[model samples]
Each structure stands twice: as C-alpha cells, then as structure tokens.
Target: MLGRRATILSFDLDYPALYYPADSGSLAGQRRFVRATRVRLFALFAAALGGAWSWRAGSFDLFGLLGFVAFAIALGAATYLQATDPARSWYEARTASESIKTLTWRYIVGGDPFPLSLPETAAEKLLRARLAAVIDPDKLPAPSPSAPTKQITDRMRSVRASSFEDRRAAYRDGRIEDQRGWYARKAVANERLKQTFTWVAIALELAGFVGAAFKAFGQVDVDLLGVFSAAAAGLAAWTQARSYADNQRAYSRNAYELGLIADELDGVSKADWPRFVDEAENAISTEHTQWRAAKGLGAPRQRNAASAPES
Candidate 1:
C-alpha cells in the first residue's frame, strides 16, 4: 500500500521515490519470475521447431513429443501458481513509493549524497535541486540535534506521501543518462562479450555446415532444419549476451555511486580519508581513459572544468 501511494505521489517534482531493499529482500521473487519466463520461452521455441520437424519428417519421436508436453505443463503450472497466489496479489497491492523505503535505507547506511568523481548529469542535478527545495529546512529532523532517527524518517515518509510522479520524471531521466555514460565507459566489457560470443556463434555455424556436408556425403542421416535451428539459436544467444553486458555495466555504475555515498556518510577518520580520496582519483582517472579512447572518434565535448582534483 505504501509503495502504491508513492507511485501515485511520485508524479510531483518535490519527492523522488526512495530506494527500497528490493535487491536483498525481494530478489528471490524477481529471480523466480525471470526463471519461469526463460523456461517458458525456451520450451516454446524448442516445441515450435519440433512441430515443424515432425511435419517435415512425416513422423514423431517419443522423446521430442514428451519434451514438448513437459514444457507445456511446466509453463502452465508456473503461470497458474503466480496468478493465483494470494501473497503475490497482496504484494502487488502496495504503492510504488515503496522504493523510497529502499532509498532511505541507503541514506541510513551512509551512502554519499552523490559521488563527486562521477558528477550527476545535468538533468539529475536539476532533479536533486528541485527535491531539495521542496524539503522544508525547518522540517528536517536535525541529524545531530538530539532528534530521534524516527522523527526524520517520519518526515521523509510524509514527503513521500505527498510526492507526484512529475517531480520525479527528471530524476528518472538523469538515471537514464547516467546509464548511457556507464555503458559507453564500459565499452571494453561490452566488446569482450561481443568477441567471445562472436567466436561461439561462428563455431556453431561452422559445425552446422560440417553436419550438412556429412549428410550430403551420406555419412549419416541429418535434418538441415535442426542444423539451422542450432546456428540461429547461437546467434540469438549472442545478441542477448551483449544486452546483458549493457545492463551489467549500469548496475556496476549504480553500485559504485551508492558505495561512495555510503563512505561519505560513514565519516571516516582523517587518517583514512586519504585512501578514500585515492580511490576517487582512480575512478576519475578511468573516466579520463575512457574519454581518450573516444578521442579519434569525435570524442565528447565536456562542459565541466578540465582541472583534475588535487591528489
């Protein structure tokens, strides 16, 4: 219900949905959903191919028939279980503001306001400024003024309640922009995945060709359709893998920012601050490396100051 309320109020520019502990708490639910989806898709694809093979061969193999039946059964059962579960329905009843709960936790865990090394996008900065303005300075529970944590928590809760999605639209846009930066910066990982999968797809295609050649030479019976099916599946998997890499990079960048925030909130001793500063420098240096990589290819024209932080 709280999450639902948040979702409704999220439209207002004053409040952005806070992060919820969805990663650790509700991750199992998400994983189950993903697993079921993958299984259903794989089964459907395989069954369709089997059906076509049955027509072409003018016969059906018992194993292939059972595979198709089993897949259908699993898909039906998973869908029924998800749809009929009362708990699932109840969970869905909550408002989208639930994310605010998660974001609050990040603050409590000492996440930085935002990492300085990776400056927030212009849109992000604007969204943050807007949210900061709506927050009444007097309403803020003083962190060091002997006020209870619950007091501050409740005020944040109130803000969440009043927020509309419009207030958060720009923040979401900032997140999307940050995602693009991370993807572009992490192109090496993307390239590696591409190269790896390209080789795998090439290997599968070559093997399929070899099987076709063997059939032509009468070495053994072969279904050219099956050969094509395997090769196509390989190529499709390669494409999906590249997409996964992009998602991974986004997650990595978000995690890094959150960790930096946490470090600042924790208020490390002066002696330890140097090490933290060094880490920040390394991250900034890597960004420079990424920029240099793009120099020959019409590199970005950054508006920020070019001066590097004093080490």
Candidate 2:
C-alpha cells in the first residue's frame, strides 16, 4: 500500500509537470519572458522619443546610437524570448496544466474512463499514455527532466481512493465552488484591463490633440506634435496587441457558464452524479480548449485540446 500510494502520487505530480510544470516553475519562464519583452518594447519607444529629442536639440549621434541599440534589443528579444508572440506560451502552458487538472478530476470522481476494469499497472499506463498524448509539444516543448518536483500531498491519493460521500464533497468544494470563484475573479480582471486600457488610450488621444493644437498655433515645434501622435498610436496598438476587450468578453461569458454549471450541481442526485460530473468537467476543459483555439495556440492539432484526454 505504501509503495502504491507513492507511485500514484508520483504520477500525479509528474504528468502535470510534463509540459506546464506546476508551482514556481510556471511563473519563472513566463515572468522572465514578459519582463524581457517589456524591456525591449519600452526601449523601442524610448528610442523613438530620444531620436526626436536629439533632432530638436541637434544632438544626432547620441540619440541615433540609442535608437539603433533599442531596435537591436527588440529584435534580440523577438528572436530569443519570443517577444513578438502574444500569449503563446501562456496559452500553451495553461492548456497543458488544465488538461492534467481535468484528467485528475475525472480520475478522482471515478467517472467515464477512470477506475478501469484492467489491473492497476495497466490502468496507470493507459492514464499516463493518454495524458502524454494530450500535451502538444509543437506550441511549447516539454520541461527539463530536472524540472523541480511538485509536492503531492496525501490528500490527492486519499481522495482518489475515497468513499462516495468523500469524493462528492471534494468535487463540491474543490471543483464547483473553486471554479465559480476563479471564473468570477478572472472576469473582473479582464474587464478591469479593458476599461483601464481604453481610458489610457483616450487620454493619449487627448494629449495628441492638445499637442497638435499647440503646433498649429506655433507655440511648439511640429516635430513635438508628431511625438504625441506617436504616443496615441502606440496606446491604440498596445490595446489591440493585448486583446483586452476580447479577453473581457470571453471571461465574462465563461464566468456566466460556470455559474450555471455550479447551480445545476447543487444537491445533485447520486443516480445522476456521474453525468453531472461529466458535464462539469467537460465544461471546464471545453472552456480552456476554446480559449486555446481563440488564441490560435492549439487549433492545428488533429485532436481538439479537450478531446486530447479529457473528452
């Protein structure tokens, strides 16, 4: 029993870690890439401003050199850190992580293909194979073998082998309740991002108008008006690049869907419990898979992201 528990726990940790790599590993690569990309973008804009300032001040050499360096840095980031790709890594990693999560949910709930009629060893092998096939290496390669281990607590194993009431309660708290909260929070976040970026873009446009007015009255150089225009354009470009509005709409829709799912599961009958679990888990996986496809990250595969394992 001891050995069996360890084996199950190890697989739980290992499979999720295969592509996405849970815990701090998830944040590290993404954080590094985001910061690096931002640095490069800021430098590019700063370079444009510097060049304008240099021309106005007749200090050509210094600003020209700065602009060249900024351009080079942006190119380097695009090449090495994949700075040009918007949310590709995020979507890929998140898809893999969520797929593993769905697999675990189905396994614990003992719904559909889980709790095989086959022997323990064969069942475990099938589970791992199905999971491995789900991870798409085309978007993001697998993590290093030396990737940090995920600590599998006693709860995952116990829950997997638990009684009906225990499993149902765990599903109630961990799946339905938790997912509702997550969807709500993410919806709010996306809305906030959209609203904030929209306001910032409007402010930039106002600034540009003010600058253009001043230049028309000959109160400032025409070149200064160009600076404000560039800033306004940059704000609009950034808003589109981030897809803040689209994400806001998507999150809002998903949150409403999850709310309905949660409500339907309230006091579910045992006879109908398995089907409920099936629908709930499928809803979660389908949401992520749809998000993946919207972002164009996992659409090229012969198998849809949800069908890869969770379907």
Candidate 3:
C-alpha cells in the first residue's frame, strides 16, 4: 500500500460539525468554489447589460422582454453545471457525512482498530500509532468491488446493498440542499432585479415629470405615454416589494431544509440515528404532499396572481 501518515484537518465544533479531510476532498472544495465564482460573475455581467438597455429604451414594457432573456441565460448556466457535476456535489456532501460516519461508527462499534478521529499534532503520536495498527489500506469500501470472487462475494454484496441505500439517502439530502442553495441564489438575483426595476422606475418617473413639464411649456405630445410612465413607476415599485416578500418566504422554506440536513449530520450518534433513514424516506413523501398542496393552491389563484404578478 502506497500511503503516508494522514494529518488531521481542523474541526468545526458548530452545530453542523464540518470536518475537513487532509485528502482529495479539500482540493475538490476549492475547485468547486472557483467554478461557482466564475459563473456568478458571468451572470452579473449579463444582468448589468440588460438593465442598462431597459433604462435607455424608456419603456416599462421593454423591461420584461430584456430581463427574461438575461434570466434564462443565467439559469441555463446553473442547470448545465449542476447536471454535469452531480458526482462532485455527491463527493462534497459525502466528505462531511463520511467524517461523521467514521467517528460515529467508531463510537458505535467499540474497540476500534483504526483511528477514530484524525490526530492534530506530534503530541498525539500515541493516537497516530493506534490508528495505523487497524488502518486497512487494501480494503477500502466503495459502491462496488472491481473483482468478484467467492471469498469476497458475500462482503461485496453487503457493501453494494449498503451503498445503494446510502446513495438514495444522500440523493434525497442533495435535492433539498440544492433547493436551498438555488433559493438563496435566486434571492440574490431578486435583489439585483429589484435594483434594476427601481432604476428603471426612477428613470420613467423622471421622464414622465419632464413630459408633464414639456406639455406645460407646449413642446411635445404628452398623452398616454406620460400617464403610463407614471403608472409604470408605481407598478414597478409595488412588484419589487411584493416579490421581495415572496422571495423571503421561499428562502425561509429552503433554510428550514438546510437546517434539517445539518441537524441530521451532527446527531449521527443519537440513539435514534438509524431512525433518520426512515425519517428521510418520510421527508421525501412529505415533499410530494407539499408539492400537491402548492399545485392545488395555484389552481384557484392562477389567473388572479398572473394578472397582479404577485405569484
């Protein structure tokens, strides 16, 4: 086995209990962070350009047309990255969960041969030696085994079955986490969207003011254009405020899910740990119920919310 003594990474004693591995997981996190930053920069650029054009055009009607285009492009980028990088997300999630699993497993199954937790310093040399004695380098558990023989067949089958269950649970958690992150990102975009709308509203209101002044001075046609411009300013302001409220509600729901996941991770040693697997299954069912409720809610108010743009 090609191996070196593993160094202990820093630990977060917070509720979530994040554990950093001094291995490949750390590098993967840095890489993901860099990629997300780049994508956000691109979205910001598109939003800025769209905002500027809508302001210059002096028509509230045009705002919707341009904003949708920008939103589509940014959303497309996010969707593509997520679809292509599912495993990366899985690894990231597993990184945290795996650390907890190792610690909790040791706590559950006593007389642990391997190190229960990574040792931090030379002073922990005794712990290092203890861990090394039981560290089985040649038999790392994975989703599947490469070679199947009679000797390893039963163990491999057990691993495969456990892997499937783990994957299913992990996927459920990932879906909720992704929803949380997406709602957060959407809130950020909504802030920018509101700002864009505010600027346009201000510009339109100013143009309307100018038009009224010009009409007083007998300059140009100030009929429907002037009236609609004033209305647009008020309408934009109302929509921004309403959307902000909706966004807050959406974020609250997502935050709840995130907290649930973090709690589940931290309490791996709870007497009711395996019950979490059952809870996860129930949670999936609960989500389906919530979706149906939302659909029912929309069915009645669809036309009303559509007209008001408050949905």
Candidate 4:
C-alpha cells in the first residue's frame, strides 16, 4: 500500500469534471474583472491628462477632443463591467469549485460523513448528493469529452483500503502538509502585494499633493494635479477590490492553525482518526468561510460533522 501513490487524478471525469471547468471559469472571470478595472482606470487617467494638456496648450479642439474620447472609453468599460458582472461569476465559480474540492477530500480520506465503516455504495451515494448540492445546475460546466467518468477512482480506493498507518500518512502528507504550505506561501505573497500597492497609492497621493501645491504657487505651467489625483484614486480602488490585507491576515492565521493541527496527527489512534480528520477539515473550512464572508457571500451550506464510527 505504501508503494502505491495516493494522488487523485486531475482529469478524472467525476468530481474533477465539475472542478476543472469551475476552476477555469473562476480564473477567466477574475482575469476579465481585473482587465476591465485596469482599462477603466487607465481611461480615467488619460482623460485627466488630456484635460490638463488642453488647459496648458489653450487648444480645446485637440486635447479637449482627446479628453472626450477618453471619457467615452471609460464609460464603455464601465458599461461592460456592469453588463457582464465578471466579479459575480468569479465568486460563484470559486465557491462551487471549493465546495466540490472539500467534499472530494473528505470522501477520499474516509473523513466524516463518508467514513470507512459505511458501505461503499452508501458512501458513494452520499458523496454524489453532496456534490450535487454544492453546485447549481445552470452553472455546472459540461464535462470534457475525453475525460474518464469514474467518481471513485482506483487510486482513491487504494488509499482508502490501505492500513491505518498508511492512510494516516497519506492524509497528513497529501492534504494537511500541502494545504499548510500553500497557505503560508499565499500569506507571504499577499502581504508583499499589499505593501507594494499601498506604497504605490501613497506615492501617487503625495505626487498629487505636490502638483496641487505647485499649481497654487504658479511654480509649474501644466495642471497635473487632477491627473495625479485621478491616478491615486484608481490605485485606491484596485487595492480595495483586491482586499490584499484581509487575505494576508486570514492566510497567516489559517497556516498557523494547520501547523498546530498537523502536530496532533501522530497522537491520533485508529478510532479517533475520523473525528481528528473532521477537526482538521473544519480548520481548513474556516478559511473558506472567512473568504466567503469577505466577498459578501452570505453563508455556505451547512454540513454537520458526523460522529466517528468504530474502526
């Protein structure tokens, strides 16, 4: 059992069929949202620059025309965003993908609500129901034509059928350790991004202040105060949309909690493993819960932890 790999197939047409498409949709939607936001902000800056140029050059026909064009572009971008609602797609797809992933982990690792003691048929049925519950039919993407159709892959069964020690090892290494490391890395990345954007916004604001002071004192001919202020406002909007600081805090806290949970794995006995796994899963779920809350997603579906059955 130790010689066999415990990894789940990414191309398996079961839960992954649902998972992959939702994940892709979420990424695509996120990219779209970011691109639209950037375009709008850039247009706004361009409009401000054109206005400043028009004022300095005393040519309303040229620079004023450019400002009007830029304003039109910004309006178009805003209309596109409002019509498509990419942010909503990003959030909904992400929510579906995460919910499916958590259910898959629980099913594979013989975690609560899908314990080893349950008959295979019953467990499979429960898993299917849970998967169906998390996703809306309208949002469910079509499965790839070439993908395999097995929900419970041979590898998942192999891991499930392994000795208690092997299963414990597999779950610890594959799930807990992987998640802890991922959260730790994300925490650092988000913190760095937050700091970078924060500094950029501050720098823009400072430049805007200096430009305004210069204009007031007649030290500079060009009116760049509006340009700098518009740019600063754009940066502030992007930073707020990203929520980098909130993510950094949540990821750091989750990583620390997972570390504490990992330490307790070795002490868990066969009979206690189910409950322990549930606890660890709940710890992971907490981060997702916090994420949903931050996104203004009211609440996720309620799933009570099943009592651990005798091993």
lDDT of 2 by residue, 1-311 (tens): 11122122112222234434532233554666566666666766766665665543365567667778877886776676654353556655566667667776766666555643335445445556656655665555445666533323345456766777777777767776677677777778878988887788788778778877887898876456566666666566566656677777776777788788767765777667667777888777766777767766654243332332333
Better of 2 and 4 by lDDT: 4
Clashing pairs in 2: none
As for candidate 4, its clashing pairs are none
Report residue 21 deviation for candidate 4 (angstroms): 1.4
Query: Which of the numbered candidates is closest to the native, going by highest TM-score?
Result: 4
Best by lDDT: 4
Give candidate 1 regions above 4 Å deviation. 1-21, 24-26, 41-60, 70-196, 224-231, 234-242, 248-311
lDDT (0-100) at residue 224 of candidate 3?
A: 31
User: Of the pair 1 and 3, which is ahead by TM-score?
Assistant: 1
TM-score of each: 0.38, 0.77, 0.34, 0.88
lDDT of each: 0.41, 0.61, 0.41, 0.78
Candidate 4 similarity to native, TM-score? 0.88
Off by over 4 Å in 4: 1-15, 55-60, 301-311
Give the alpha carbon lDDT tens digit for every residue of 122-175 in model 4: 887777667666776565445567644565666667767778887887777877
Q: Give a tens-digit lDDT track for model 3, residues 113-179.
A: 2122322232133322322332233222221233221211232223223443453334334433544
